[model samples]
Target: MFRLGWFVNYGFGAYGWNQQWSGNVAQDVARPQLFEQGAQILENAGFDYLMLEDASVLYDIYQGSFAYAARRGLIRQDPMPLVPLMARATKHVGIIATMSTSFYPPFIAARLANTLDHLTEGRFGLNLVTSSPHAAAQNFGHEKHFEHDLRYEMADEWIRAVKALWNTWEPDAVVYDEANGVFADPDKIHYANFQGRFFSTRGPLNSVPSPQYHPVLCQAGGSGVGRAFAAAHADTIIAADPGIDGMRGYRDDITRLAEENGRSGKDVKLLHLISPVLGDTDEEAWARKRAMNAAADADQTNQLAALSYISGIDMSTFDLDEPLPELSDRVNGHQSSFSVFAKLARSGKTLREILKSRRGQETVELVGSPQTVADRMEEVMEQVGGDGFLVVMPFTRRNLTDVGDGLAPVLRRRGLIRDGYPYRTFRENLTSF
Candidate 1:
């Protein structure tokens, strides 16, 4: 059996990228303290990890940067820094940060992850994203984003190189031979001379080996290139889809991919993004969702955010009250956009209908009481053969406390959720497949 995890879907730019493309939820709706509070809430509730996505460039779902400042700012914090802050607040849950193999060098990536692993006491995970969109590459001084297939090809080698650097310092490399005044055993240190199509890295990283060895590798790509990268290196795969059959297909596809690459079903864990609308009863849950929907100015903000992040479509071009225009395949490479738009067209949804699909991306939304929520979760797990789920809340900690405080108990009652974290490290928890 696999464990369940939650995605921290709150905080700075929680709804969308850039200031102009907000969910219209006050700019300062959540602060650092609140983020810290959320970390505590999820950690205490037995969440496996919190993901912090990284992007070098900020654009609307349409991929435009013109309205970035008008929106607010591209993003607030450098995502890498958030890992340590979150790690300090939680004892057992993992800290996963997104780092692009396209921009950062292998040595730097390895050292940063290793440092976080040490700081987090071995509760670190790596969400390996191959940066897409030309703007993202331009920010990093590249002329253009590498083609999709090529990016994954580079990522494959990048993973091996980073792992080699990480393995440079052996488990017993640090030796406090006080009598001899030797702090490290020279024999335990090795050099990683890695040369690949995209990079040539030479290293013995500044940090020593962490308990997790290679921090739990996570992949958030859903494309062919993305799937290939995940199969090769990912320990956990993040996916967003609406139906149980789709989740199962994705799970099985990745499992087969892993096996073809010489790994097993247990080697990689599959997580579905779950945005839950929870209440005491089914009717109450539906009412709460309606209230949240009513409170949110979904039309302008949601579509704008979607256009900016998913496709390069300009939200301002479309009328807020009007039905969504039949959009062309304008996606720059992100698969999530296509999925969202497809849902809109397939369901014969209007612009508002699509915008109101789910506040937090197009992940399958479960609306019901705690028992209903847990039952749906079990169905997704047992019937779909899913490893776990990434619980995405509709609003802040105030609006949605039921996932942990309410639904988790129901899961526990059915022997689905663990009573307490049974492992010390992130890998140990995830690898118990």
Candidate 2:
């Protein structure tokens, strides 16, 4: 009963890092085009969806300069356009785009999501996020980012408003009854009249409910409030837990929260991120992993800079050989990343040492032959309970093809992952498992 999806970061120079040495010559084509092709591959592999993790602004926190972020081309484009492109390219795999509830107004989000859901025939999902970066606040004309828990509160209101708008038009509102001299049923439509401290929307969305009723809601954050938000609202929780025990604890905690909120905890699907380096043999996979790491080492400066960008901590000021300095009591960005790395840093390990450890570097790793990779995934899912995983494909097209051609078939034959999607809508496909 394990499921799989691709964790695709679609903005900026997403695959620019992979173009350095990968065998994919198509890197010359536009990234959006390449992304569409990749989506097709994932659909053929029976992946549930391809989610776009996004960052809106530049990462200048590392050294008080945008030069590093610009040079790396980290994440620079709007992620919305790619959604329809992906949906048009494939029929089954879901398309998820990231949008910030803190920044995007409820009406706009509702319209965009509803439109995309219809275009994809109910295969669209929204990964709702609260803008995390301090600079992002400046872009939105706010003095500073909202406090950690408060952002979630704002998101809660945003969800309520958006959901109310979606439900305003009942399912039968659009009844093209020509014989009755009416194009629709007036009683079927009603105003939302939703009012909240952070957001309020009146009346129904212009469009009727899409095939899935509402787009599948996804939440991905590494903080306590984030967990609560996901447990209460999201159809899927894109978890980034690296170890079995950690994964179990995260799932249990969220499930309990869901129950406390008077909802079934099992309603939230947990998907942990893993990147596997696959080969015909274990040694070869390890070799490939080392090569990939070496390439990353060449750009370690940008890598660490990007880390600073996400963690909201300027890592550049610290000496590589010195233990990490004490971080803030709480980070406004990815709280878990800061907490986890800080704990590792306290072992008296140098910044360099911590990044070098598998625990620090790889979020979730499985490097081996097909059988070995499959075995590890099965064991982890069994130990961690239910839900599934999000596979991080190497930026190279070859690695992408290798995953679909090399590993997915093995997973299908072994019955660890599904061979085909049984439902038409994304939520149905997810719940069908």
lDDT, candidate 1, residue 132?
66
The residue-by-residue lDDT of candidate 1 on 1-433, one tens digit each, is 4466665543243543333323344543444554566677777766677776666666644424446534554454566676777777778878787888889999889998998888888988888888666877888888877876777888899999999999889988998899999999989998888878778878888777887878889888787767878988888888886677778888888888999999997798888887778888999999977876775653356446645555545666666556765665435556654655655755656666666664555356688998888887887688887688887653355533567778776887787866667788988876764
Residue 215, model 2: Cα distance from true site in angstroms: 0.5
Q: What's the CA error at residue 248 for candidate 2, in Å?
A: 0.9
**RMSD after CA superposition, every candidate:** 3.8, 2.0
TM-score of each: 0.87, 0.95
The list of candidate 1 runs beyond 4 A from truth reads 9-31, 60-69, 72-74, 293-298, 318-330, 336-363
Instruction: Give the best candidate by lDDT.
Output: 2
Model 2 TM-score relative to the real fold = 0.95
Quote the positional error of residue 193 for candidate 2 in Å: 1.3
Number of clashes in every candidate structure? 15, 1
